[model samples]
Target: MLLIVVLCAFVVFLLVVGVASFLRSRRDDSDERIRSRLGALAASDADVETVEYLVRRQMSEVPWFNTMLQQMRWAANLSRLVSMAKAPGTPGLYLLLSLTLGLLTGYAVFLLSKMLIAAAVLAGIVGYIPIWWLKRRCTKRMDRFQEQLPEALDLLARALKAGHTFGGGMRMVADEFDEPIGSEFGKTIDEINYGMDSDRALDNLLNRVDCPDLKFFVVSVNIQRETGGNLAEIVGNIARLVRERFKLHGKIKVLSAEGRISALILTLLPFAVAGVLFLLNREYMSLLWTTELGRSMAIGAACSMTLGIVIIRRMIKIKV
Candidate 1:
């Protein structure tokens, strides 16, 4: 029944896509439609302290939804996440999809199981699917950016050493590397070319990218602009430092692999055992939910599992 509900939702999504494509096909060129939304990507919020930044984009295409989302703090965040990930669809669209899925899945679960707890839990997880996928994509993009940063900075430093101007070096990096470093630097270059200050452009780049090492590079550039210094040498040192940090982080991750594996096993073990017992003898396993004392024990076990997960996560996560 839940599968049917999900399939129905997916079918509706396909139908919507088909209608949009059919309408788009009537136009001589759909490029305009694509560019229309592309131009609305990667906007800055006006809340930052350093610059009185403009809200450069809207959260939704629908006027009412856009206006409603404008009042939400998290809506902007979702916009930022989508921008960073270079993912399709608006925050409002994602939220609407999540809500729809949650309602459908929750109703289906409640109808089948007749348990409010099961319904709510399934609903929450189903609702979070879009967000989870977006975050995963964002994290992957950030990691790629982080790994590319050192080499990009080195290339820029070498360009400077070869007597290329700062802007020229930036253009070189933008043209040479792949996304997200390439696109991010390209955006900065575009901003600079369009009469925006270099400082502000770099700040915008840093805002779009959640990389710590990029901060060092941006701050160094800003400081160099203020005080006269060998900018190329400073960038070179930053690249070396970033590489060293990467090495150390890699070592730490390797060392903590055991703990992470153990945590994963520990987390899934209870669910696995419960599932097996339920399959082997449904009546015996049903005691966990059927009696008051059993329910209390189950709740206690859940709390303990949550606590263990938190502790294990903290232990394995060593920040450089």
Candidate 2:
């Protein structure tokens, strides 16, 4: 059947993608990669004529397409998001992948429903998956960076109390800590040493890292530079505050477990019932998708279910 052919092709595509991802993860050249990116940060200064010639970021490998993407702000944002996520592949490459998958899925849906509008809408929605995946990756990386922040701060505080200079303290953190915090601080130090203003370097780090707690650290350091304070004590206090917040975050997660479970059950209840009915009465359940009116009702039910899930998730998600 056409459905089988389409599904088989999709499965092949998924297999290829999964294998590629596994291989990339196993590449494990992160140290050299970190050094190269840190080196780039120094070279990318506005003062460096060499930086102009360096291919810092390309939205696409293709000349015309890259030029077109350069003119599009959203595409540039996507390229930046990829960098922040430390993800491989250009925006153009991901777009191509999404388009291919969307076309495959849309064709299959068309084959089943013979509905142009529905197929097109579904294709558009599905095409966003790759971008959504990149954003998800970025968020997870940022969360990891945040989790590492408190310890990095404590390390820096210890370095300062041991009589190291501010830059030296940062260098110690860079050498001792792991990524993304290590690479981030190392990059900031590189920028500052390479003639960028300290403020500018820290601001660039802030842009690269999306942790709210880092903002407190940055603001504290800046204030210390202006008004003068025991920087070690200040940083140590921030570290303690961050750890306390983590404890509170754990408590919040425990408290919200019940709402999460309820939401999950509510979301799954319809699917469980549908499965039971299908097992008990295949012909009746089959009519749902096998007829026009049944298809319309199925679409309505799907939309309503999606809306309900979104509302429930929003209700349960708590911010730290």
| Residue 318 accuracy (lDDT) in model 1 | 99
Per-residue alpha-carbon lDDT of candidate 2 for residues 44-131, written as tens digits (9 for 90 to 100): 4454555543545666655666678788878878887887888876676676567767777777788876776678878888978988
- Number of colliding residue pairs in each model: 0, 0
**Candidate RMSDs in order:** 5.7, 4.6
TM-score of each: 0.83, 0.82
Clashing pairs in 1: none
Rate residue 2 of model 1 by lDDT: 91
Estimate, for each residue in 1-320, the C-alpha lDDT of model 1 and write its tens digit. Answer: 79767857765764464344334334333543344233323223423432322334456555676789889887889989987887766666667667767877887887876667767878988989988989999999999999999999999999999999999999999999998898788877876765567888888888899999899999999999999899999999999999999999999999999999999999999999999999999999888777778767887897899899999999999999
Quantify all predictions' global Cα lDDT against the true fold.
Answer: 0.80, 0.80
Candidate 1: misplaced stretches above 4 Å? Answer: 1-56
C-alpha positional error of residue 52 in candidate 1 after TM-score superposition, expressed in Å: 12
* Residue 49, candidate 2: C-alpha displacement in angstroms: 6.8
